[model samples]
Target chain A: MTIKAINVRNQLRGRIVEILTGPVLSEVDIETAGGIVTSVITTRSVTELNLQVGTEVLALIKATEVSIAKI
Target chain B: MTIKAINVRNQLRGRIVEILTGPVLSEVDIETAGGIVTSVITTRSVTELNLQVGTEVLALIKATEVSIAKI
Candidate 1:
């Protein structure tokens, strides 16, 4: 598979429903227009970006590196 | 699948081969005693942990969440 500049492989269109930034990993909760499709956790998110609730963002993914779950 | 205290699931025993820390994320380079089986990218690893070269580590993985390929 082709590796992007960063590990972020594909741009997944989603809206930020919740963002829980703690002492460690930043959990950016996203909800796609389709349904409760996926949840992503990345170490890269920081408070300085000002990524607030109800923000529109892309859940960049590596198709080869993605895992799907149903809840 | 059981979720560990963290996203880290099953421990795929490996050794800390290398580590690259940048402003954004920490890239942990691990090599299994077996061979180049897998590589993991977690936002949780830090320099303070002193996860150094030849250090023993567990490349925890989620059974249901694992994807495999060759290099």
Candidate 2:
């Protein structure tokens, strides 16, 4: 139930803002350092149970989900 | 080619660390505020062409990619 956040160097990053677990898929709170809060759900069971607000979370998200953009 | 970063409210966030476009799919550099750098690719044509270092990027990642975990 302990899913380690894969650090994708030269990619993207975030912090574990919140942690909500369930019997089925678990939702992870990701607060993008830029001030955005993203709730990520996973089928894997998380039991570490040490997530808190402002905790560092990594987004090893795949390329299919992310794309280049200009602000 | 003006693709906007979809902000996943209550989800993850990041900055457009870099933007390298090609004739086809484009590669986006996302520096997670926390420190992880992730590259996201998209088939959509991004024409805004206004990305740079330390730019705010939103992850809008799907639940299937995110999961909860302890420290």
Candidate 3:
């Protein structure tokens, strides 16, 4: 299904630079303009999305799950 | 308690620009180098962290929770 819109605020657009596959979780690294955005998602999603190196994708991050650190 | 290190990979440093509070969760808009990073964390964390406007903070995001959207 095609998503019209999403509530996630931080959406970094980039290309998949690397994919580190694990038992359950997989790390998909995207090279964005800001920097390399690393995302660890389910291995199942990795396959379902047909993700690969050079595939353009957006790193979607929800507001609620974001933690803050004092610097 | 002071945290020595964390496993989260994405840590965007920025300052709090705006805060929209709610009953349970609060929206924290941080002005980072790339852009405005919005976070919706628990109201308790907001209070416990002593977050306020102009507070310098690092927005931490876990890799596993990041979603991928192909474009």
Candidate 4:
């Protein structure tokens, strides 16, 4: 998916530090240059991404209300 | 901070699930309606937010290249 924003605030990079799997949700921890970021992705996404500890990923965050635009 | 975008794809609301403190950086876990969202903020932000395990916060993410736009 492509995400374009007129105002982008935060985009941080980190690695998967840990992954905690639960019956309903899975917690993915990412260790970045600055710190560690955690994401609760579906067990499906986890399987799709094949995310494991030490995988490099990016965490994109915007400190505003987000709307979708079709390009 | 105000985050605005022409295209916003994902915005999830979650509660603070956990916080891991280190010497320089801190890990923040937010439990949302769908899942958990993790953010790596500075120790300063952690202190400023006064984030605990149960703090409710919004985890805003956009799957795109983000730029800053000033209004």
TM-score per candidate: 0.40, 0.51, 0.86, 0.41
Fnat per predicted structure, each in turn:
0.00, 0.47, 0.77, 0.25
Tens-digit per-residue lDDT, A1-71, candidate 2 = 55354443333356765667776756665655555445555435344444566766554555566444333
Clashing residue pairs in candidate 4 are A8-B67, A38-B38, A40-B36, A67-B8, B14-B31, B14-B32, B15-B31
How many clashing pairs in candidate 1?
0
Q: Per-residue alpha-carbon lDDT of model 3 for A10-41, expressed as tens digits?
A: 88788999999999999999887667789988
lDDT of 3 by residue, B1-71 (tens): 78899988888888999999999999999987667889988899899989999999998988877889988
lDDT of 1 by residue, A2-50 (tens): 6456756676677777665645556576788655433434445545556
TM-score of chain A of 4: 0.70
What are the runs in model 4 whose C-alpha is more than 4 Å off? A1-8, A65-71, B1-71
Order of the predicted models by DockQ, top scorer first: 3, 2, 4, 1
Best by lDDT: 3
Candidate 1 per-residue C-alpha lDDT over B4-50 given as tens digits, one digit per residue, 9 for 90 to 100: 35544466688877777544346777788667544534344455566
Q: Please state the CAPRI-style docking class of candidate 4.
A: incorrect
lDDT of 1 at A45: 54
lDDT for A19 in candidate 1 is 64
Runs with alpha carbons beyond 4 Å of true place in candidate 3: none
Q: Return the top candidate by DockQ.
A: 3
Each candidate's DockQ? 0.05, 0.39, 0.70, 0.14
Worst ten-residue run, lDDT, model 1 chain B?
A: B36-45
Model 1 DockQ class? incorrect
